[model samples]
Target: MLTIKEIAERANVSRTTVSRVLNNSGYVSGEARERVMKVIEETGYVPSENAKSLRTKKTRVIGAILPKISTETSSRLVKGMDDILAKEGYQILLANSNLKPEKEIEYVRLLKSRHVDGIILSATNINSGLTGEIKRLNMPFVAVGQHIPELASVIFDDYQAARDMASLFIKKGHKRIAFIGVDEKDRAVGHCRKLGYVDAMEEHQLPIEEGWVQKGEFNMESGYHCMKAILEESKTMPTGLLAVTDRLAIGAMQYLKGQGLSVPKDMAVAGMGASELSRFITPSLTTIDFSVEDAGREAARLLLGYINGESYHEKPQVVHHRLLERESI
Candidate 1:
């Protein structure tokens, strides 16, 4: 419970000199800084974040709103963001929305109430309500995974990534391809990805059956059901399959195996989000490496720019993606 005045007295330096050494602001002589450091080390004195924030109007804490905290994608994104933010002496305060749109907006307001320096939203869905809430807050904000107009964002080319995977299937002589996706409310993963698959199929003059396209939730259980629906309903069986997520693809593969069908031999499968499980899974999953961690880093950088009063571009920052070909395909 020591104060700066006490430390300054012990160090035999003026309070202003101690302040300079602590904040790294202005300038302090080397000898004065050394003396301040010795006193701080001897007493294990820690600066009060509240006092510093009150003086500087900066908490040095960034609020991160994630769709789901337990997922690998979220973890990787957090790791990337931390890698950048920590070096800048910023800490992350996490808020999980659990894939609920209403919760996303609620968290925005809560983070603002907490006086966070900035917010990074790893969004699964974007709507007017959420965007309006963010705009109303008038704080430093960065959206990830989906583009928000007039707002800084770190996004992936979900459309092109899906197209690339579908094209790979076509190149491998797959004419009849099935698609497993989530609800279109998740525009990036559900809508754009489905569009990419459809466009690719049409471009190659491949016919798509109505039953071949199945919508499912963002979980393995949903994937299994969607695959079952596709198998039961499609008049003509698809030779290849593309899922919007690795979990969905893995679930479909699991269903296929239970039915005594072999992967690549019966139906080639591919998914997005090059998750670690994708690499270790049986037959290995062919997936897209969207560089999620890089997106997190980019989002952190963009948020920092906003926090630091830097001029920012209105256009979304797009992260590159690559297809990881594996035995499943």
Candidate 2:
């Protein structure tokens, strides 16, 4: 409806002066700028994003590709990213890859083609091929929640955090401990957490029994089903469990409860990554406090750095986290 020309005509100033006022640039006299902006507001003259983007080459939109976006843990990280970017007057162009590496790559290409200002990818891993594309496109991006050795990733020390939780269990007199993890992909936190369990078990000289470890998808159903299987296989059931994440722990706890086993009374459960329900659940989950918000903030920082032509070659950034001891453990 209302255009910059109309505002310029009404204010008797050049169109460039009206544009400067619209973008909040202070080059024009304050009185002129204020008059132009007031007329702009009254006239309901919203600038066209496409036209502005074409001229300035800034969409003010950040692209993001996430694995299983609806999941509790990953969604928290997404929310954190959205929160930080929104405050800076930027929007997120989101895509979901459903935990598939190939799909993630395809989405990466799409984001680049769309000319997103920056991208935040949470995926299986950044392959050697993907790194080459990153170099060629020179897009601003950072991987989140897991490690990518040669890429700028916003991740937690997942392995150490889980290991610390396992060590805590040992301190509480748990000798027979079980670990339920997800598949081992290079950048997946599930396997990293499982590695932590192994580290703790090896360091404490606890027997790494064949049947004590189980791997499954990180979901409530998988946790319940696999834990039930572990219960069935054990002659002397485990005293504690190191779940790959809070989602898995919640599932495992369900199975434990259905079998007439009480958490921390008959079994102790601890997991990596705290969730909202972790503190309010029946027994109150004992978990590692992996800070998604911190990772998100740092991811934004890395992207802005890349945008500014400051590249940190292959040096990974690690976010800090902690093991939270609660009633469940």
Name model 1 segments beyond 4 Å from true.
none
Tens digits of per-residue lDDT, candidate 2, 292-328, equal 8788888877877776688664767888887788899
What's the lDDT for all of these models? 0.94, 0.81
Supply every candidate's count of residue pairs whose N, Cα or C atoms clash at under 3 angstroms.
0, 0
How big is the positional error of residue 167 in model 2, measured in Å on the Cα after superposition? 0.9
lDDT of 2 at 40: 78
Tell me each candidate's TM-score. Answer: 0.99, 0.93
Q: List the residue pairs that clash in candidate 2.
A: none
True-structure RMSD, every candidate: 0.8, 1.9
What is candidate 1's CA lDDT for residue 123? 92
Output the TM-score of candidate 2: 0.93
TM for candidate 1 is 0.99
